[model samples]
Target chain A: MSAPVIFDPMTLPSDDNVNAYTFCVELKGGEWFLQKGKMIAYYGRIEFNGIGHGRFERLLRTSFHSPLHASDWVVAQGSGKMLLADRAFDVNSYDLEDGNLTIRSGNLLAYQPTLALKQSIVPGFLTLIGTGKFVAASNGPVVFMEPPIRVDPQALVGWADCPSPCHHYDHGYMTGVLGGLRSLTGLGGTSGEEHQFEFVGAGTVLLQSTEMLMAEQATGAVPHEPGVPGGGAGVPGSGHAGQGAAPRLPGQLGDLQRRFGL
Target chain B: MLAVDMSGDSVKAKNGSMVAYDGQMAFKKMSGGGEGLRGMVTRRLTGEQMTVMEVRGQGTCYFADRASEINLVSLHGDKLYVEASNLLCTDAGLRTGTTFTGLRGGATGNGLFTTTVEGMGQAAIMSDGPAVILRVTPQYPLSVDPGAYIAHQGNLQQHFQAGVTFRTLIGEGGGEAFQIRFEGDGLVYVQPSERNTIGGDV
Candidate 1:
């Protein structure tokens, strides 16, 4: 057996990836906003402080805008090279130039302080604004595709630039009595790909090769505003989309008449 | 998967790790990791027990463990300290023994005793992902999260460091409050994924 390559601070790349599953970020008396518990190792002098620390009040006010996710984030400061990885997933760093990118909250690993982090209006997503570098992890290699395409919800990783994203249900399979019956009860052969997320306008959509998703991070509850998607919804046990409320039998055909406005 | 061609020389591997083999091969379970009676007693008392088997043959033997990534470490007389569970196979000429590791072992949830292999031979360790080998120097000390640490070699001094303050009690402590600081010169092996450690929540 032979020893693997041993990397030192001098040999480690600056603000780049060490491999497909690990990324190295070099800090020269600067700071990076990191997700809690994502740091694997580091060399030199570096201090990790929670976002609620008193000294970071000003920094938090400027860049850290999502108060609900405060507990899951921290600020890494000082001079050192740190290694970040998540669940052995493929990690990559992207540079944003005075632009915004929306990503799944769990996929994001760390970002520069120059970028402002905010919760996206769409649930379970985060938007980073300004010009800086941010690291993200995916179950597999991420593929960049132009908009004007529909992507499976589980395969979508994120999107860069402005694009209108909305739900696109296959009207042919979702309308009519037979379509509704097929969806409500798996009779008459219901293809699982009847629904997708449609993206239009100009932007880049990121997709992972595998449909397996990383464990979803708690994005925190949105404000109880009237127009919010998940805000007006009550407790999870009360049931919003017919899940957890009751166990329907195989041939029950759940809410088919209501869906058809019969 | 690790494939080793053996021409009469034997190798000690984890029991039940042989996946497939071709040609001539003899598999025998070595009692007490082939370390005699004293090693058995020490391993039983220290709770660092590992069941190893000796494979000697004239053909090719394949070894695998749960489809994990295998890392090869070459040792030229320096001692390799690793968790018993992470050790897969080693040259039969190497000496395997149990040693006390104090607080660092407790932090990793691997007990207070660790397995040490020494000699001029090669050993294979298993990890969830490919291990990253980081070189530690006297000038640049390395601090690692306990959950991600796997093994280390060469002259190194490790200290189990903890940062606990009033903020920690209020759940506002830094997420990386518990870490293992390694100084001196050595090579540290870290997996890209973290195991659930005792100090993981802190």
Candidate 2:
């Protein structure tokens, strides 16, 4: 067998992938915001500090808007090249030119401080807005598709520049009493593809080759206030009372009585 | 999967890792990793026990474990130090032994001893992903996270470095608190993913 290629400080790629699973980012007295515990190795002197570090108070004010995710991120400062990876997943870096993209919270590995990271309106997603480079990991290779497409929810990595992203249930699976009963009880054959996330408008939709999702990192709970999507407050009938009710499985037809026109 | 062709030779492999074989092969359980009594006693005392088997008279034998990525390392009179759990197979001529690793092993949660392969021939090690071989020189030392480290070869001195400070006590700590600093000339193998180490959270 031939000898494997060895990487050193000078030969390591700057801001590029060292391999399909690992990415190298060179820092010249600069700082990058990285998720905690994603760093594997480094060639030069780099210090990883928690986001709550008193010195980064000014930096967090300008670039970081998601206070809920503060505990999961860190600031890598100083010079040298550092490698980033995530559970051996396929890691890729994308450049954003004054654009906004929303991605699953757990898929994001690291990002430049130039981009402002905020909690997305959609629960369990984070939005990055600005011009910079960010690294993300997917279970398999990422496939980019145009808008006006409905995709399996499990295969979705994220979407960019899209205006509408809503749940799309198959018409046959949601209409009649038989359909509702089948969906609710799984009495008949359920293809497990009855629901998908539909995207419209002009943009790119990112999908992984596989449907397996990375473990979800807790992005922290949203505030309990009105006008919040998953704030768990202000909804009169669907408050904590819903938590006490029987757990509803995904694709379950809600309010069977109402569906029967009772 | 790794396939080794043998006409009338023998190879040491991890026990129960043979997935398939196409030719005549006699498999014998190597009591105490074929290291005899001294090595077995040392490994048992160090808590770095390894169960290996000797496969002899094989045409083509295949070995695999847990669908992990396998990497081959060629040694020419040098030594390769690896975790016992990551070692898959090695040539019959190579000498396998356990060595003290000091604090680096403890921090990685792999005990205070590591398995070492000496002499010539190729040894197969496993990693969570393709292992990145990093060349470490005296001029450019390398600091690696304890969780991602798998193996290393050549002449090297490793130092267990901790970045824990007062902030680490109050729930605010650099996620990468424990690292192994390597100096001298060697090749360090790091997996693309990290294992759960004792100091990983800090």
Which number leads on TM-score? 2
Candidate 1 runs further than 4 Å off: A1-3, A233-255, A259-262
Give a tens-digit lDDT track for model 2, residues A114-195. Answer: 9999999998999999999999999999999998999999999999986589999898887777888888888898899999
lDDT of 1: 0.90
Give a tens-digit lDDT track for model 1, residues A53-147.
99999899889999988988989999999999988899999999999999999999999999999999989999999999999999999999998
Residue pairs of candidate 1 with colliding backbone atoms = none
True contacts kept of 2: 0.82
C-alpha lDDT score of every prediction, in listed order: 0.90, 0.92
Assess the local accuracy of residue B158 in candidate 1 as a C-alpha lDDT between 0 and 100: 93
